[model samples]
Target chain A: MSIGQETVLEANEARVVYNEDSDNPVEAVRSISLDLRKGEVLALVGPSGCGKTTLFNAIAGLIPLQGGRVSVGGIEVEKASGHVGYMLQKDLLLPWRSVIDNVTLGLEVRGKPKGEAKKIAQELIERYGLGGFEHSKPSGLSGGMRQRVALMRTLAFEPEVILLDEPFSALDFQTRILLQSDVKRIIREEGKSVILITHDIGEAISMANRIVVLTNRPATVKTVHEVPWGDEVTDPVAVRDRPEYQEMFSTIWQELELTNGQQGKTMKGAA
Target chain B: MAMATDIGEAKKQTAAPPAPKRRPRNSTGRLRIMAYQVAVLIAIVAVWQIGLWTGTLKPYVYGTPWGVMQAFAEQIANGTLLRHFWVTGQEVIIGFVIGCSLGSLCGLMLWLSPLWAKILHPYMIALNGVPKIALAPLIIVWFGLGMESKIAIAAIITFIVAFLQAYKGTQEVDQDLIRLMKSLGATQWQTFRKIVMPGSVPWIVSALRLNVGFALIGAVVGEYISAEEGLGYMVYYAGQLYDLDSVWVGIFSLMFMALILEAVVARIEKMLDMEK
Candidate 1:
């Protein structure tokens, strides 16, 4: 707890309940507290349908929490409107729009003048290896290219913290690894705080400086591990080759399996 | 020698198959289809002429091909057909403009206000369910036997088709895109303009294509009931007088007009890039 990192985002005892008053009310997240530090990538890893996404949504101010609070740069998150940059599992690029137009979407929504937005979008596109595709439609781009465009779009808005909800899950295995390093490098260069929600443990370990493992439904943080790889480990691919990678992977896997076993036992007892 | 033969056989098996032959050009296929259509039309006209010459068909009842052509020429020479064609064309154009605008506007309004849509849903269904041709008499009575009645009828018919198409299109827009826009801090109006309106362009164009036919139907139906001038009136007058050739001329003119309208709508759809 005394790692001496400056906190960029904090979620305190955050709780989320769906259909609060209905006959079959469901609690998705329960009293989860965590901190995201400046210039660090925090990955949330858990079982499927474990409310990791729900927590991400709460942190992004997309959904109202029943209790507790989420703050970015010490300011309370009231709503999603211009608060956090969010990337969903799908690219969600507008098909009718060209690549540059889609990238400038956030700026356009903010009412930035067209010329200024286009200039910024053009620079981002060229900077991120998406040059020569400024006018191509989203349909024409490959999956990895499209995701890069989406990332560039989020970056263009310059939010305090970025919430990535399984942004690489839809990509192929090779592309996922490549993008993992690419995104990590870009984010590190920008020096932005990010909270990545991922089901893939390898992805979590590869990209994140810290990982939070959570329990199934009504999810709570089961454990938090700080990645021990030092500053020399700049590339995600290089980090995977280190001798400590397998050990860390197995440790997190065991933690996940423990929760799975507990849930299985509970189901058996009920049946 | 046996080993060499086996190697050659293996290579033959592993080699890629020959590429399939390319199909004939699409333009050639289209030309062939057109030729067949023309032949069918010529054959039908030839049979009609032969039957008339053999006295097996009554020219007064079915009308000979030559007689129909003569009637067409006579009408053109006298300028009556041109006048009637102009009247019907005017009614259709005015009615299409009014109907398309109102339908698109109302459809957009309903999309923005679901409460209004729910309240008016049943009434819309009821209005659309009634055969618009049945309303011809009432329309003429209200708007009179002039071009006003024809235009009114055409407008109502076009309105129903256009409204339904636009409404469906608006409803079917990608929810994900809307959510993305909202997350970007877009206001409700900006979302509607940038996402909803552009998304519905295909539906609006399709509606325009369908409404062209509806507009023509409404105009002709209104003219059939009571009108001083129009192709429909000519048809009705010719039928009453047992001038079958003149009736055929009127029908052909309406068909030709419909084709032209459809082509114009298709061109507009292309310009809008609705196919993309």
Candidate 2:
């Protein structure tokens, strides 16, 4: 690896293990190395049990990595820091807080006076279609709208890197595409780096500049698809429907085909 | 608890929530609720008065509300009512303030230290189960029948309830929100202050509102054990003297005091609801 590009997040031989108190503790992630350049989206794509979330956890400092190091902006992050923002599966909006107040939470914790943060948050809310809803509580919004508020919250802090742990997985199919497109536009306009954790191959293909494919539990990087649509991609759903998208999907599918088979058996039995 | 919540909800049909508006139940649901409560009181008294009339009920066993009212008038005329009422109010106010603060602080401390939480959790739970009256003597022995003793008893009663709830409230903070804050690089204290504290506000307020009753009970009961002059002491004296009316007056005064304190604390909770 040249290691020359402006890397925002680098996980060198990052390993993670679930240290269950039980005797047979399972390894969640095994020896993974990856680099996400600034202003780029690096999507982690794999099967259901492929340790994608585990890797994201390791990177975000949500879990302690058993091996190697993860850094943000060249500084080691032993614990998850505000330098990165993680939009969860749900919007995770503070239900009591108004949409604008939820967005300004990070700033408030950082001791930014509320007045300034609120103005910036208001602008972001209005800019990204949450204008009238600023004064509303999280309960008032739909799933898609809630996610938008959450995205705005993550964006408000202006972190160097944002970690998205299946941020759109909760919404139905149609809402997912719209919010995903809005998110893509916001990311580009702001020029922040993102590490998107998703199982959907199509999602990986359309939005990411590079897709990191991983094996099931004890996962390591299987391949990196230097995706082709970085310049051509505009609409998230449109790009997701493109022919190349299907091609990218099959390629990663073939790589994780074996792990997917095992996962299918366990999931079937569990269900 | 379910009945209490339902009663609270049923009374507040007009509470607004266009902007996270806090819905208070009009402090025990207004004087109408009190009227309903009074009706129940009257029905019980009517049964007792009939029992007295029929000679089936001993006067010593149950006194009529009218009889209690008569005794109340006598105390009012003699001016002993003012003395005991003032003393009881002072003890209750002082005990309430001390108890509530200690309980709230204990709650915070327990929530912050999991190690101590593990060790003390069982003890706290055990104490809550034990009759606070059972320990009243022990408390008096330790702190004396002075105001400190009364306050201490009240604090113990209030603290257990407050700590259990506040600890649970602190623990009940949304995990996803904490994760989001962590991913955003917020420090532990930042997460606690911004996310944890704010999340616990509603729970804390409700707990505080509840502790008001417990604190009052603590002060009153402690006074009953051995106080020179207090509402509880006055009631004890009246019962001993066979003045059932005076005893009844003291009890009613206590209910009135409890209602007033609840209203004030509830108002304070509402003012702080802007956190939402």
The C-alpha lDDT values of all candidates are: 0.84, 0.77
lDDT of 1 by residue, B1-276 (tens): 232233223321112212333656898897998999999999999999899889999999998788899999999999999999999999998999899889877876577877777777666666656776787788889998799999999998788767766765676677767767766667888888888888877778778877898899999989888988999999999999999999999999999899888888767767777434
lDDT of model 2, residue B10: 38
Q: Model 1 captures what fraction of native contacts?
A: 0.43
Which regions in candidate 2 have their CA more than 4 angstroms from the true location? Answer: A1-5, A20-25, A247-257, A264-271, B1-60
Task: Report the C-alpha lDDT of model 2 over A91-114, residue by residue, as the tens digit.
Answer: 778877899998898788777888
Report RMSD for candidate 1: 11.2
Candidate 1, residue B154: lDDT: 93
Return the lDDT, model 1, position A76.
91
For all predictions in the order shown, the interface RMSD in Å is 2.3, 1.8
lDDT of 2 at A1: 16
Candidate 2, residues B1-276, lDDT tens digits: the string is: 232233224322212222444555787677777789889977987888888899998777677667787888888899888888777777667766766667666766565566777677556556656666577788989998777888787777776666655655666677777777777777777777777777766666767777778777887888888888888888888889887767879988888888898889868876876555
